[model samples]
Each structure stands twice: as structure tokens, then as C-alpha cells.
Target: MASAAEQLAANMNFGSFQKASELHKRIWFTILAMVVYRLGTYIPIPGINSAAFAQAFGGQSQGILGMFNMFSGGAVERMAIFALNVMPYISASIIVQLMGTVYPPWEKLRKEGGEAGRKTLNQYTRYLTVLLALFQSGSIAMGLQASPGLVDNPGLFFVISTIVALTGGTMFLMWLGEQITSRGVGNGVSLIIFAGIVAGLPRGVWQMFEMTRTGALSAFAMFAIMGIAVAVIFAIVFVERSQRRLLVQYPKRQVGNRMFGGDTSFLPLKINTAGVIPPIFASSLLLLPATVMGFLANANLPAWAQWVPGMVGQLQHGQPAFMVAYGLLIVFFCFFYTSIVFNPDDTAENLRKYGGFLPGIRPGKRTAEYLDYVLTRLTVIGAAYITLVCLLPEALIGFYKAPFYLGGTSILIVVTVTMDTVAQIQSHLLAHQYEGLIKKSKLRGGGRGR
Candidate 1:
């Protein structure tokens, strides 16, 4: 059945796309939203010396700061309004999710409140995002002022304005993501981050070509980088689509000479259920402190704050400490976020409710335990895959001086987002085809159609 569906999807042509008017509307809306986001990345903040700010952040581009800038769509380098990006909102959502685990009230709200409850929690996340954005933006404001020539007007007004602009930009991005999720294609937040990382692709490729032309980068090295990129993309495609299918059988039933049930299906569990979230969460969390301290390092401050920047600086890109931390965080979030999103007990209960039973397992407690066991094993492998894929690019950057945007995490995100978005588009096309078939059936019955 899945193969047949895949074949049909592959056969989708221009006519199919033209017929899918609603899908086209969603696609266009998504493109317009993304374009608006890209424009925001170029809009500089008030009272900041663009050239000086660029020099300051540009020097740290090879390290953790570079990764941050990539996610921000080069907003940090320009001191743009969107320099903070959608990170604070993501971080806040992560916090809210973590809280849902430990805090009983929050958990009840998530589990029992339904859509309204989810909306409430989302409201809480937005509020938290505002607070986080304020703190980070303020730190940036203070840092820019302290840095030589970065702030054209270094005073309370400049700091206040910087905080306001940065915070407003983040809020707007949060709203934009919500809009995309509701009325556009793909996940809004993920698409925004994807756009940011990809915006630099053209520039990075150009830089490499320029280097080869200048005899600075050997042709062999550039080709090797391309090879590595292609290999990584292929690996992502293979693993992402890989799934474990558990056979489920339904007992035969008959009523009024009509046979029902007696069919088998597979419950497909994805190898990486967490998607690209773990790396995004881990990187966003790590960057918050690094960004604050990196900026604070140069601030005209007393002796105590000096240690903060020094400690963060030690975890620069290519450092052993950095790799270890990144790997550990990825592993932790992989299991953590996966658990939050998927619950074996719930799945088992639903299966039992519907008279579905996995082969060789009881439908209730045993099924739940078995599902959990399988998920645990799969998650272990998934964590390793994610950690390896994301860290490989970082390692490459550290050793070969590759563009930061080409890192494993960046590539993983790009590939994952691309796959997900394509899947969504295909699903829309499938729905459109289904509608066409239904219309044909109605017309065959000589029914009037609108």
C-alpha cells in the first residue's frame, strides 16, 4: 500500500499541481512569509555602527558565534533587528516542555486541557520568550556599547532602543512562525531557521570558488568538501525514512453476512522521532550563555564578570570541550524530547481500545512495555546518528576551515527540513487527487456538482 502511494506521488505532474489550488495558496503564503523574514534580517537596529558591529561579530565567526549568526540569517553581523531570531521562543518552548515533565500542574494542563490548554501553554511560552529576548538583547546592547565604535550613541537611550527593537523583532518572528503553521506550508519555526542557514549558502560557495581562484584553497579540497556534503545528505535521507514497523492484527468479525476486520497493519515508528529538534534546542541553549558572556567579556566591568567570558571562550569551536558538550547535549535532548513527544503507554492503550494487538504481546501492559523497549533501543541509535551527523560538520569546520553554515548540524537541519516540507507538499497533492476522484464518483452517479 505504501509503495503504491509512493508511486502515485512520484507520478504527480504539473497538472496535478495546477489543480491543487489550495496547496498553491499555502505555498505562496509560505514563500511570502519567508521573504519577509529574510528582509527583517537585513534591517539594522537603531544607533548601531553597522561596520563596527560587523567587525566585532565577524572576528568570532569561526567559533560558536558563527553558528549563532548562521541561525540568525546573518542578522548578528549586521546588528539587525532580527539578530536574536526565533531562538528565544524555541528556548522558551523547550523550558515549558521540560516543566511539563516535572511540574504536575503544567503536565495536567498539557494532557487534559486539549487545544485550549495547548494554546494556554503557548501563551506562557510567548511570555517567557519576551523575558528571554529582553535579557539577551540587553546583554547585546551593553556589549555593543562597550565595544569600540560599535554603538554610535552609547547611552541609556541606545541600550533601551536596542532592547526594544531586538525584543520586538523576536516577538514578530514568533507570530510569523505561528502564522506559517496555521496558514502556510511546513513548520514555521523550522523553516525560518532553515532559511537563515541557507541564505548564506550562495555566499559561502562563492567564497570557496574565490579562494580556489586565488590559489588559497586547492581544487582538491573544494571537491572533497562537496563530496562530504553529498554523502551527509544521502545519509540523512536514508536514516530519516527508515522506520520500525510492528505488525498488528485485528481478529475477524462478521455481522449480517458482512465480513469486517481480519486485516493486518503495521505501526510504523520513525527511527528519529525527535526530528531536528534536539540539535536546535541544544545549540540554542548553548548559544544563549556564550552570546551573553562573549559580549560581556569586553564590557567595561568589574573583575567578577571577567571569568564568565573566559570560561565560554574556552569552549570555542574545535575545542575538545566544545565537541564533548555538544555531543552530550544532543544525546540528552534526543531522548528527552523523544520521550516528551511519544508515549508508549498511550499508544498501547489506544491500540487496545481499538482491539489491535501486536504479535506475541498482550494488548495492555505487556504491549506498552514492549513498545517502550523498542523505542528505547531505536532512540539510542537515533541519538548517535543525530550527534554524529551534526558534529561531523563542526569537526570539518574546525579542521578544514569550512564555512560554518556547512557544519553537520546545519546540513542535518537543511536536509530534515527539506524532507519534511516535501512530504507535506506531497501529502497536499495526494489530498487533491483524492478530491478529484471523489468528484468523478459523484459525477458518475449523475449528481449535480458545484
Candidate 2:
């Protein structure tokens, strides 16, 4: 027999959706938030010489700046106020999460302090975001000043204004994402990034067609690219939906004159517990060095430091070294993030407290060990899968010069966010149906009493 929620989902249709007023409100709010983000990408910052910056950016568009521009929804390309986007916030989050594991006080707070502790850590992440934004934006400002004609006025005031504008833009985006999370559907930050990538997708497709028409790209190659993309999408859906279920059984117990407890449940562990995070983190870290080097390229450097730019160049897009580094970082973050999000020890203790045990497994320390063992194996498979998905785009970009919008990371973000949003909508519809059923049952009971 299907579960009640599943049955409700099966019965759901357009009529059910029309009756979900709250769901409509959330969807509208999310759309409004995304629209605001898109508009911000077109609002350029002060002191940028538009023509000069465009010419300069065109030359570096195939490099790290291009990737950043894609993530920012062309905000960087436009020299917009939101050029920094929410990258600083993401970097800050990674740092804070890393700290929570190593720092004893933070570890205690994460494990024992509960909601208050989480709030404190979020505050810390915000503070760190500010610091990082200041640094990154300041570096960008100075880099622009070093490039002649890039800035309208090359002076201290221009630097201060640019820093303030970019940093303020990043902070505003962070807050906007939070609002979307609470008041709208889907993850605020991921949706923001998804909106950016999707906004550029039509242009990317048009450019590809233009290439094919101009004979720059062969028709066969174009078809192959499309086929690969479709295959990758199917692969992502399958892997993301896969999970391992562990059977958990509860002992029979007597209460008063009746038997109270004797039931079975499952502990479902996803194959990819840290979904879409490892690839995002790995990309961010790899882009950092290139960002720094790109900025410093405008500066007068000694002969010894000239090699830095050459080395950074080797790490771009499809280079072997870049691929190796990207794969390693993805694997590392896969395990690292998994450990942070799911604690086997805590899970085991909770199960033991509730008198539940896995079949043929010890209840306490041994259960924790078993869970950790299973998760580690699952993570290894997950890491390999993520690495393969992410690397395919790098290969295309490197060899075929495919558009960044078609990259695997962008596709993963788009697909994952869409799936999550749809799931939430389904859940809301199910709840609404359940409420209706309850009300109808109460009405029948009241009628009988009358």
C-alpha cells in the first residue's frame, strides 16, 4: 500500500495547486526576488569607464573572470554594483564550517548549544563575509586603477567608492537570499545563482547556433554536445535520487495492560548527502588564485613574480593540472562536508535512546561505526560521480570551447534547485489535502452528534 503522502501526491493536479494559496504566494515571492537580482546585475557601479572595461574584459573572458561573470549573471561583465555577488558570503560559510570542526568551542556549540549556537555561527559567517568582501573588492578597485582608462577617476576616492559599492552589493544580496529562504520557495542563495546561470542560457544557445551557422562549429560536433548534455542530465537525476535504506526495528514493550512498542522503520541515507556543494566549493577555491593573479597582473611586478601569471594560466579550464586539482578538491570537500552535516555518533545515540536497533547490529558504539562505514563508502562513490560530472564540462570547454552556461556545475545547480523546489511544492499540496480530509471528517462527526 502506498503511504498517505504518496497517495495524496498521486491525486494532486492543477485544481489542487490552484487551491494552494500559500504555495502561490511563496512562488510569487521567489519570482519577485529573482527579478530583483536580475535587475541589479544591470546596474553598473560608479567610476567605471564602460568602453574601456568592456574591451579589457573581452580579452580575459575565457579565463577565471568569465566563470565569475557567469555566476554573477553578467554583473562582472557589466561592472555592476553586484559584481561581487554572494561569493564572499559563500567563501565565509566554507571557512566557518571548517572552523566549527577544528575549534573546540565551536564544536561544542555545534553539538550541544542547539539553535542559539547555529545563530551565533551564522552571525560569525556574516562578519567574515564583510571582511572578505572588503578585501576582494578593494583588490578589484586597485586593479582597475592600475589599468589605464578602466576607472573614470584614478584616485583614492574612486577606490573607496568602488569598495563600498561592491561590498554593499554583496551584503544586500546575502540578506535578499535569506528573505527568499524564509518567505519564498527554494534555497535563497542557490536560487540566486540558478537565476544567474539561467538568465545567460538563451544567449549561450543563440551563440552556439550562430557558430554552427557561420561554419565555425561543425553540425556533427554541435549535435554531439547536445547529446552529451542530455545524457549528463539523466545521469544526475538518477544519482541524486538514489539512496540506501537501513532497516531499524523497535522492541515490543508493555504499557499498562497493552503492548505499546513494536514497529519497523528505515533510516534512509542519500548517496550524495552533500549535494551540489563539493563542486561549488572546489570551483570557488580554484577561481580564487586566478582572481588574485588577474588583479595583480596590472601591477608592476619583478622578474621573479612574472612566472606567477604563467602558472595561473596553466590552472585554467581544461589544463591537466587544473583537472587534477579540481578532482582532488571535490573529493576532499565531499568527505569533509559529509562529516559536518551528518554525525553518525549522534544518530546512533538517538536510535539507542529510542530503543531502536539495526538488524544484527549492536545498538550503541557499534551502530555508529557501521553507519560511518556505510557513509564513507557511499561518499567515495558520490565523489567519483561528482568528479565525472564536473570534469565533462571542463573537457568540453578546453577542447571544444563550449559556452560556460552549458557547464556541468551550472546544469547541476539548475537541476538540483528545480527538483528541490518541486518537492517542496508537492509537500505543501499534500498538507493542504490532509487538512481538507481532516475538516471533512470533523464535519461528518458533528452532523452525527446533531
Best by TM-score: 2
lDDT for each candidate structure: 0.89, 0.88
Task: Residues 197-260, candidate 1: write the lDDT tens digits.
Answer: 9999988888878878888778888898788888889999999999999999998889999999
Top-lDDT structure, candidate number: 1
Q: What is the lDDT of residue 118 in candidate 2?
A: 95
Candidate 1 residue spans exceeding 4 A from truth: 1-11, 212-220, 446-450
Query: Using alpha carbons, what is the TM-score of model 2?
Result: 0.96
Expressed as tens digits, the lDDT of each residue in 169-281 for candidate 2 is 99999999999999998889888888999999998888878888998888987888788778879989999999999999999999889998889989999999999888878
Which stretches of candidate 2 lie above 4 Å from their native place? 298-304, 442-450
What local lDDT does model 2 show for residue 217? 82
